[model samples]
Target: MRRRDFLRTAAVFVSGASVSLSALEFLDPGKVLAAHPQLRWAFLVDTHKCVGCGFCVKACKIENDIPLDANVTRTWVERYVIKKNGETVMDCPKGALDGYTSKLLDQGKSGKVLVPDKEVAQAFFVPKLCNHCELPACVQVCPVGATYQTADGAVLVDRQWCIGCGYCIMGCPYGVRFFHPVERVADKCTFCYHRISKGGNTACAQACPFGARRIGNLRDPDDPVAKTVLNQRVGVLRDEYGTKPHVFYLGLNKEVR
Candidate 1:
């Protein structure tokens, strides 16, 4: 109750915490990564099947209890339009939350005919979320040891331990990590860790009306998703970065970053 007693207790608690963490510091994270168990998870996103409804985005925010802010997005959708002029433009205004509609445009007098939106060489919707890399850069760059992966292959941030230094955000090559709007801590999609761990579907996967997203366990011999991944040319984003992400995409093109 006294000031001196309170100070002494605080110092003891801090010292104990330091000692506790020092023990864990020697544990190799490479050991965490190198264990090639027969049980790992994966995700598939089919761009052709997604309608840009934004339901997945909405469901992700609601299920994760993330507030709606202009600057913050845990999941979002982008519309890619490749013009005939060999120019590509992508847009995701408001995360396509209201869904996409016809956009009015003016005709230009550049002597060459302008391509209409519907007549673009290519157009599709890509719903973006955490790639959940096998060798997550965010986890590697986390200075305070607040980010790590689980045994079943999900990357997560420890909210209580995170110091909000933004190192993980910078380390992510996929642009999936962000500083939470209210908490100001590193935040990202955990592939709905709580539900997935309990053998349930992710919010986005369940909310998707068209069945464009599929969650799969590579270890499962009878899973249809595993068969699909094996039969199709599944793609990973930024493969050159060597993140070795668990999430794969169907119909992914060079137009997307």
Candidate 2:
């Protein structure tokens, strides 16, 4: 039988019990990669289009089984206000689930109160999530092999295998990883893998009225989102880390980190 097919059959029988870390080692992703050649999922964020409505944040929580009141989230949005003097203020209160209703921004690293609108030169919203890097440090730091990269380039955690050592959480440079309050395992965005794998859009993308968040198959030359990344100028957060993050941003501001 083909390797991919064999793994599928093995998974069926193994579903009755927890799969051990050593047993998972035999499932070479490289061999199974041939089963999916044209399915590299990519995500895009248009800063110019995002309105900070928090609809995407609410949708992600509902779709991913995250508690509505939980402080943690699979995705969140940040509001950035740049002052005329080049001072930047950012906030993501309640993960932007309530939207930016308050004119007063939180005192983040700046430790300063929100400046007056007259002093602000510009303002925009930035959405943040797991970058699903091509070279995922989280996967490498998982001592029990709980975190891994899929053939489609998604970084995922095997909750059953995870020992909750917190290594993967620390390994992430983007500070996206967090310990699930209930599951007690490392949790982060999966690019809505369960939905996207079924040929459906992510809840965040589907709920977005402004089309700020988008997803596409990078391997498909004709894919609109992929075409944008290929043809248009895009930016990524913390390129200095050399993680090769898959999430790209359009209209990325110099002040944004």
Tell me the tens digit of each residue's lDDT in model 2 across 1-257: 89999999889988846767677677669777676677888899999999999999999988988888989998999999999998888888889997887788877666547579899899999998889998888889889988999988899999999999999889999989988988888999999999999999999999999999999999999999999999999999999999999999999998888
What lDDT is obtained when candidate 1 is compared to the true structure? 0.83
> Residue 232, candidate 2: how far off, in angstroms?
0.5
TM, every model: 0.80, 0.84
Q: Please give the lDDT score at residue 231 for candidate 2.
A: 97
Worst 10 residues of 2 by lDDT: 106-115
TM-score of 1: 0.80
- Name the TM-score of candidate 2: 0.84
Error of 1 at 225 (Å): 1.9
Off by over 4 Å in 1: 1-34, 104-115
lDDT for residue 237 in candidate 2, whole number 0-100? 92
